[model samples]
Target: MERYMSLLSPGDQPPALLGHEDIQAKLRKWITRRASGSEVSNSALIISLWGTEGAGKKTQLAHLGHYFNEPMLFVDMTKVPEEEREGPDALDNVFREAAIQQALPVLCGFLLQEDSEAMRNRKRELLDRLKTMSGIVFVLSEQPCQPIDLRSRIDLELEIPPLEGEKRSDAWRTLAAAYEVDESVDWGILASRFVFSPGQMSNAMRTARTLSEWRQEEGKSGPIRWSDMVEACYKQLNHHLDAKAKRLTPKKRWEDLVLPEAQTKKLRHACNHIQYKHTVYGLWGFDKKLSYGTGVSLLFSGPPGTGKTMAAEVVAKELDMEIYKIDLSQIISKYIGETEKNLREIFDEAEKSCAILFFDEADALFGKRSEVKDSHDKNANTEVAFLLQKIEEYGEYRLWRRTICKT
Candidate 1:
């Protein structure tokens, strides 16, 4: 089989590739791994670069656009209207020109925007069609949407998380070099505290500089302090989560609550898990032994308003993080499986935010299974089972459930 480099233009006047070095290196490694000894087939190699919006995915791809010559069109799906992108013929229309040139298709935005049933079906069809193409296909999406049976169409896939570790630290230093940062400020601490992308970090720096000037004495700011940068980072993070779940800033603490010594001690232990997670899981190396990150979930069972909810708030206060209450009844719908889907979406977001999830009236959903009298009973039982699985799958979340009935 030819090298993965074979997919690029062979002409002397090859187009220019513009993404970052790491991404380009990752792509090269993926291609090398695939082209090592695999048999050549009519099937195309579909690579999906997935990440959240504004995480530099589309920009990186666009930069690489100059490298691909004729037949390999780098389509920016965002330019396509929401209606056109979701239509059934979206894929066929984009690929028609390439198809006529007998060139491989590089379909973008299979999951870049809000997804619908029609878009999902079209994406599924596109994956099937890629199987018969004789060249490599590159797909750019926020999240990869692979068809069940057509999963083989994907040769390699990559997901970009928030700019982390050295990359994040580098971004901070880059900002500090240009800004009036004080010697007291620690770039490493700020980088560790905020899992921000390059775009977010840039915005945060701009915000910090603006805030520094606003609070400046006689319009003259002292060297940008650590406090200013962190404050800006919090501002960026706080406003984003409100769109997903209710943002809670708890004033309550353990000292404010009157509970039994035993109960209070248990609550203290929950806070310990959240506090020591980075150290135990990351620094102490216990994270490797565990399948998932250390997540501690507690079921606050008792009467209504008997400080059950308050305990969760106290823990959130202890951790200095926010708590979000999601009513189980509100998430449960008449439609079958909708309840499970809603729960999954909530848990997924909570996993990332590291916020305390206090699901009030959980017994309504997590109650004991009943004998199957009808399909409704069976579906309810299935939902309960899925809830259990999802709880285990949420590796990096702290969950708190309250119930009226003791189970």
Candidate 2:
């Protein structure tokens, strides 16, 4: 059995849930209504909590049990014994067990997998069991449940959004207090530098404490310094974009880029946009007026080897951010929607890393939309449109470098 899957009684302490007050309030309301039997129409209430990994979906489920004040059974579907999962009465048995204990059944791993006959049968079994079972069933997923049959059965679909801005800073403060981190540490700086989820924040603090202990053993005395916490934060990030993009360490600074005075000024202006974005958006009230297109998007068009790439590096170095050169061959897929999916992953990872994205030879992907004569043409245009949308939605720096050939 997976260690994550287990039965917990009401006496177990609920995990500390941070930075999701809206979700907590919704869960509380739902549980209260169900408990009073006033809104009790369905035999079973299926609630799906979906978000990126480490966004505290499981923590929210634990919170639900605390609110419901009942026993809770947590099951990781991927870890269930094959014999039991394949068996016809397996789900029936599990639900029966939950019923016997009067526990809320919380199921994890509802991601879309291959639609095989066995998978279809499993979905059918789960649906039937859900229709017959009573009380609340919580489904945890990395993404929203996409299967129609299973999706329709979900009563409430709540997204545990990533902690951002002040909420993220607040989470850092809360975790720092719990871990007894140095009160003098600038949590706002840490929060600004790292776009970490609450779970990631906790893990970073744990790692920071471990580092501090090692320092004590080595006779190097000090509290958990800001540097230790920063290193820990970097260690917690799993870079999923390596497969799709190449990370470029920025070494070139402004002096290294030999450009015309006008071009150099333009580059400096772009860097300024990124540097003072928070001030301009938050303090200047631009964020309230503008809902999108807040990110800095710059186009570097010059002859090949005229320092287009170097200019990008200089910008990244100026902003003190990591730079990634997106691999067009790896990102543009022949299959419809695959390109968009790949872009989404790249954008998501870039956001977490707070890195500047550099798209070299951008004409191929961002060129004028081809006239639609067939489905392929239409799909290509759609892919470009989707890329543009993601670029606008991305709240960071995106630099596109295009070669301008002399005619």
Candidate 3:
């Protein structure tokens, strides 16, 4: 073990993978099969690496480049000028440059926000050329474009999930060891509370260290404070949740909460469900019993300032996630069918975020229904019923840490 650790030293070799064993193995196998004449997985060479913004596509590609001892060409498609991105010749030139540079595993990022068929077709052209000329190709997108963008030509599709459980812990440990920070830092707490990707964690460490250094004089080498790490982790995930809802940093704890003991206990248990649902449902084989509604959806009923919002924040803080108060004005619509559409957009975003979804003023959505005598009444009932069904069905998509906080 000591010898292996020594070999892992950055001086001896490039950075160790730490947690991406499966990705490394698949990437290496594909590179080998593509290089050699050996029959491969349907002779497919185009691989798509996609996830959220900071889910570590570029970093993973770097690791793959290091593993294969090859140069990588990273192209952020968003940076491609609007005129250049629209034209086929621009992309064609970029591919010619990558080939001339003898770059392997070209990483290109495409944002669905600027989604255009011309852009997608240009990407397709590059992908086909790369498969024939380059070592491998990686297409990164904000959404799941594996089937649509890459189509059936995907030799390997690596969707880099946000680091959770042991992977998160491994990331903390790996960066901590590299930084040589105090070993006493609570990595388990960080792992539990932050749904950071490997790249985000790397940025968090750098930010933490810089903050620590700025707080003290040089050569003193003060420890990276726990608060610094917490703040840094929070900042890394700040940009995504702003449009849909406001992000909260809970200054309150269970001690600060003033709810009745029974209610508090129920809230605590619900938070636990968010933290360890995978263990109870998957490891203990409890998932075999029931199908839908594995997520904990509870109604926190009380008057205003009854600690409902704070409890949501506490759960998010305790579980190392962000809390977003869904904007009710945008969600609850007067127009028919638009309510469901808005709710779907919010839920869809929340599913990816894995944050505590605090739907405040939710009584507006869930009200006592009378006999449906009119179209308005029927539409209201339908909207309420649709939300309930979607909330119940969120569990089918592996939302282990997604807690639905209703107020």
Candidate 4:
């Protein structure tokens, strides 16, 4: 509870403790308790710093490591062998080592905690070794994992929350001080302009420092301009967002699309329905329940260079929504029912952003529904049915599902 100044030594750059006072306190308590050689149990403290990349996890980690006065060994789970990350084989090895060989002392106990008796014996060798090790272990993962398995052996699970309001200002002050900038600038206004992670903040400050020094060489006495800060923040946040589908705006007109008269007329009708719905559809008259399927579902049946794909892009451009082209190979998996899981990801992403779902050369998947003569046929039909159902359900809002025809 006391005001704790960081005891970080030279060469240890601790992250500026922004508005995370409560979080810092909790982490400090955990570190102190752990360092005293207390019986913390087999349960490991798993603190997950989750956010958009530029949201500052690395800087926070550095700061946290300094506060604890302990070296943080990062294990990037993403870099782990993908073959091992998937399937029963890798898990089998883990269990086997735990139950038979008494290896992987740190993770073996956690591995065998599962309820399955069959797995217990499979892992008994490894569990014996894990029962001896003490202290905390840290793993950094970009992708989500099966938490139940980890939770059984882990104790604490914390998600780093976003900074807001006063906390944002406090973060800026710390960042500015670390970078050595003129304190006269109002950072509260700047912080409100863009959201950045601690790592991003540090990088921006570092860049600003260099740029400011460069300006000083030219006899400029003022701190970094608001414009330069804006640019830095924009670059940092843009990288975090990644290369997302473009959000078409009003200014991006749809005049470039070359479609047949019927398709063009239908598209215009769909656009009108999307834009000015009440005047034409007679809002209350038509069943709103049916609106779920009201989303534009058009099959652009044509050869590759015939402008089918262009037409879909034009539609997205007109609607001011992002256009997402689903990868069919990824969608259609060889594993039974695995194809549906991939479909769920595509549909879920489209739903969240309300982006135009572009299924280029989609006849390969949505072929004429055939009788289920075999398991493959049955699975194919099921996939189609699932797709149809999802489109009918979540397509309540303005959505465009464009499928290009291949022959």
Candidate 5:
């Protein structure tokens, strides 16, 4: 029980919080108000920080502790036993620890798994306990609390947005400087190519350092190079996408893609959409105008053995990104809602890896909707709708190949 909790004293120096100046400012202002004894609520001030994993929620919590200028009790709720989790016993222990140490309680890992009556009751109880508490409390989650019961109780809910573009480049440079990485290593190129979270960037740098050390052990002595960092970043992304899609090494180049000049020009333009998206979208203010359909989605429709698959590889190689051939058999499911679940997983993994999704035989999934005569037909249409939504929502490149049979 004690192992699940740790005290983060004010003297303990955590890593610097990066790329969330707005969030940091809000947190500091909130803490300053509290410190000045300007109380708005009699109950505990619960600040909920929610975002994608590795988006630095814990880092924000640590920074929050620093702003509070007091000892903070860090509770990892995931480590608590399931039977005791959300129970009075666990709550009692947590409050007891915080009270004994005179520390602010920072609880993380509050994932709402289900919406059953029992779960609702447990959440209500938790809310009641939190509202009665008399100090500042922090809740960190990968997602915002969906339940109105819990959401209404939260005093402040700030989303820690993922680092992108310049922010990402800055994070790369900052971490490199902290880790004493080779200054010659081109972080800007790496940042542009990889849509990595700050946490991922840190992991990649550590892995790159390890690779450099391994080379030294084999009698090659040098600092971490660009190639080593690239390899390390790919290593961090490799495991998540393998289960859903088959990773393809893009061996095809533009010269190998034998198509008409007009068709070839269109393909190049499609590649440019991805290549210079930051310029067009970010720099030119197009991102503010469009809400959806920002991702580069290409539908390659042609007869069999006519280079649809080869074209996808060529585009991937042109962009210097890994391509994953999505396995239709693995994604499409017989059970209702299961297909959407699988698609969400695939898209999420693709986003993390920054890989091009190549869907071969894509018509099998994206075909015209049939008449709504049966339950199966409705489910099929639902799946298609969900797939289209995911494709539109995807921020990177997605290539789909449809085979047309010619009589």
Candidate 6:
């Protein structure tokens, strides 16, 4: 308890001692708040740091965390659970995590409290402060942020600028100290060969150290070579990038496609449009911007097993995106207006990863509108109109529409 008390003190912190020229302003601001007796505010603290590989963000964060003395929670946004993803309300998921950390527990605590009205109101006020107390420092590696609500919440954004000339020299010096490499090794030559993040650099150093000890135990006298460091860093970088791609596990490949030659060519062309990023809608004259018209819509009017779904998978694989086959039977409901809600969620979730929306039984949903005979008919027509609107707005992507005798 005594050790924890020093965390709240207004003394000069470790970050202020760092000789790095760029971090001085941030350091001053942090110390000034502490001196003023104000709790370090986390309300508007959305700091986003980004840069090319080996720009040294993780190193900077380590220094800053030591200065703050508060636990810095580095959330890898790229690794969100599937259930927390976009299907229903993603905002709810954010709230759920926040609540788990007692970020807004005071609100719930009031209901459970057996105190009188006056005491309960005072407790409620204390809870208000709790909402602002659980500050976060989330670090997203390379995750694609699709939902607007999620993007809007991020506050302060900083990128680790690309190192050149003297900055590169300084980075190498830092690496040397942390790595404990031989003085004979050429820093300039070694720095030029590798593209690594601070996290990768540290891991590589730790790995080299471990390897060196193992070799020493075997009575070997060779220094840790640059080749070994490169191989280790390469493996770590590959693992990180591959994990990002794994979020959307590809189900099928191009070979699984078994459509007619003509249909296959058209499907392949559509995939090319997405892959090469061809601007067919913009007539290819303009730079690859989508024209502001009805999006590239296509109708795959054919029998089942003719490779409509398989073609969709090829498009997903080519573009490096996800494919979500919509089960219309489950989505389409007997209750009025519920069908539209389900359809909206389907489109919304599909839009997050720019997923290929494969409506398996196309004719069932895209059937011709019936006459205005009864309430059920009118409701059914309304659902059809909504689906048509969503499909139209669903931009240039592989949309497979399977059919059977045209209903």
Across 1-407, the per-residue lDDT of candidate 5 in tens digits comes to 67889898877776867687678888888777875665666788888888877888878767766766788898888896777666565477888889999998888887643467888777677766787888788887887776766678777888888886667778888888756466667665577567777788889989999999999899988889766887898887754888878989889999898999998999999987777776766657686788877778888999999999999999988877788998676678888999999999898888778778998778779878999999999999999999988988987888888899999
Candidates sorted on TM-score, descending:
5, 2, 3, 1, 4, 6
lDDT of 3 by residue, 1-407 (tens): 11111111112244545577677677777667676865543332677777776666666666666666666656666566666554445455456556666664344555422447765666566555545543456667766652365565556666767655566777788888767466556776576555576777888899988877877775656788776787677667644556767766666677777878898887778777766665665456675786767777766666556666777766666655666777565678788999998888777766656566777677677777768999999999999899888888764222112224466
Give the poorly placed runs of model 5, Cα more than 4 Å off: 38-42, 81-90, 111-114, 179-195, 212-231, 237-244, 254-266, 299-307, 326-353, 362-391, 402-407
- Compared with the true structure, model 4 gives a TM-score of 0.43
129-201, model 4: which lDDT tens digit per residue? 3233344543333322243453444344455666754566578777776555654455754553344555567
Per-model TM-score, in order, reads 0.57, 0.72, 0.68, 0.43, 0.78, 0.41
lDDT of 1 by residue, 111-161 (tens): 534456676566666567665555677777777554444445577677756
Q: Clashing pairs in model 6?
A: 46-156, 48-158, 50-159, 50-160, 54-196
- lDDT at 70 for candidate 2? 78
Error of 6 at 65 (Å): 4.3
User: What TM-score does candidate 3 reach?
Assistant: 0.68
Best by TM-score: 5
- Over 1-407, each residue of candidate 6 has an lDDT whose tens digit, in order, gives 12111121213243211124476357436544654555555452434454554455544655555555433333332354445433334324444444454331111101212356664443344333333444543333332222333334444445555553234435556765756565555444333334344445556667777776677789975676554454454445432222112233456777777667887787676666554432332224342343433334556766666666666666667655545566566678899999898877666654443345666666666668999899988998999999878877765453647576546
Instruction: Tell me the deviation in Å of residue 6 in model 5.
Output: 1.4
In model 1, the Cα lDDT at residue 106 comes to 58
Query: Which residue pairs show backbone clashes in model 1?
Result: 15-66, 15-67, 16-66
* Candidate 4: Cα lDDT at 142: 33
Model 5, residue 181: distance off in Å is 5.9
State which candidate, 3 or 4, has the greater TM-score: 3
